[model samples]
Target: MTALIMIGAAVLPSLILLVYFIFGDRFPEPLGGILGTFFFGVLTVIPVLVFAAPLTEVLQPDLLAPIARAATEGFILAAIPEEAFKLAVLVAFARNLKAFDEPMDGLVYGVVASLGFATLENIAYVIGSGDGWLSIAILRALTAVPAHATFGAIMGFYIARAHFEPARRRSMLFAAYLVPMVLHGLYDLGLLATSYSGDIAWIVLGLGTLIIAVVWALRLQRRLRREQQAMLAGTAAASLAAGPHELRG
Candidate 1:
């Protein structure tokens, strides 16, 4: 019973985020495609582990100050490799597909992909926590899972902009990677440092980072919705203009 509850707690948060992001769209993506993107997201862990393992091996924590060590582990060892692979998966699988016509699609797919990654990570953490799995599960539900969703939203926001404005792909692509990378890194840095030093400040900042991520996601959702609505309204107007005068109604 305990293990079952632990697993549910770990997965439920990411699933909720997934459902919210999917239904939030005016035109929700096809269920089949969303699941496909999610499957690809699950596969992304393979690459992250492959690349991250080597870097982790090389980065000796004793050589640096505690703060610097935390930052290096979070930013360099974890965030860069993980976010890069996720960004690649988003670009490779969904960016050019017919389903990716609107900005909202970017948000949808990005959330899906991020949730997939979070789900896997959650399972690992829960199972690895032994008798204390319940605490680990609850803590991650609040922190890690939502953080992943926020990073996904950030990546997708820029991806949507990049799709609409191809000329700005270079800069937008950079933002897509940089924004989440920094946020995830800072999140990890704070939490990891707190774990090592027993400093409440780092924990507070880490939680603050998650709060910022949630706010940013909400704002991005609003922006994407507005853009989608405007485009739809323009299409309606153009269609009406092309209709016969008597049929204008």
Candidate 2:
């Protein structure tokens, strides 16, 4: 029972986020594609572990000063590798999934992919806490998991635009990788710094980073939604202009 409870708490946050993101869209994704994307996301852990462990052993981030350590761990050790694979998975699914028909699909798939990775990562983290696991679970549910969601949303938005906007691909792709990379780095930086330095200010910085990320992601979602609406309206207009034979409606 204790083990089941532990696992449940670990998994619950991702489930809630997944459901909420899917329902928030007027067109929710098909179940099989969502599950498949999530599964690919979960598999990203394999690459992250393979990538980060060797680098950690070589760099020894723990021995560095708090701020330097935070930067190294936050960006080099965690965020870059994790986000790289997540983006890779998103790219793969975007090419393969038929449901990925709009810019909003990018946001949705990006978030779900991040959630998939976060779910497995969270479970490992909570279970690793041993008997006193509730705190870990609850704290992560509130902060870390949601943080991943925002990063995914932000990354997905740009990557989707990059795909659709060939002329803007260079700039859009840069934002896709760079924006989330910085946000994830900053959030981890503050948290790790606090842990190492035992400073309230460090945590404040970390929490503040997450707050900013959340706000930014919300704005990105709205922007993507507006673009998607315009695309749909344009398509409708084009079809009507083409005559009744070509109209999808």
Candidate with maximal lDDT: 2
Q: In model 2, what are the clashing residue pairs, if there are any? A: none
Q: TM-scores of all models? A: 0.91, 0.90
Q: Count the clashes in each prediction.
A: 0, 0
Please state every model's RMSD to the true fold in angstroms: 2.2, 3.1
Q: What local lDDT score does residue 235 receive in model 1, on the 0 to 100 scale?
A: 92
| Local accuracy of candidate 1 as per-residue lDDT tens digits, 158-178 | 887898898998999999999
Report, for every candidate in turn, its global Cα lDDT versus the true structure: 0.86, 0.88
The digit string of per-residue lDDT tens for model 2 on 56-82 reads: 999999889878888899899999999
Pairs clashing within candidate 1 = none
- Which runs of model 2 end up more than 4 angstroms from their true locations? 226-249
Runs of candidate 1 exceeding 4 Å displacement: 62-64, 232-249
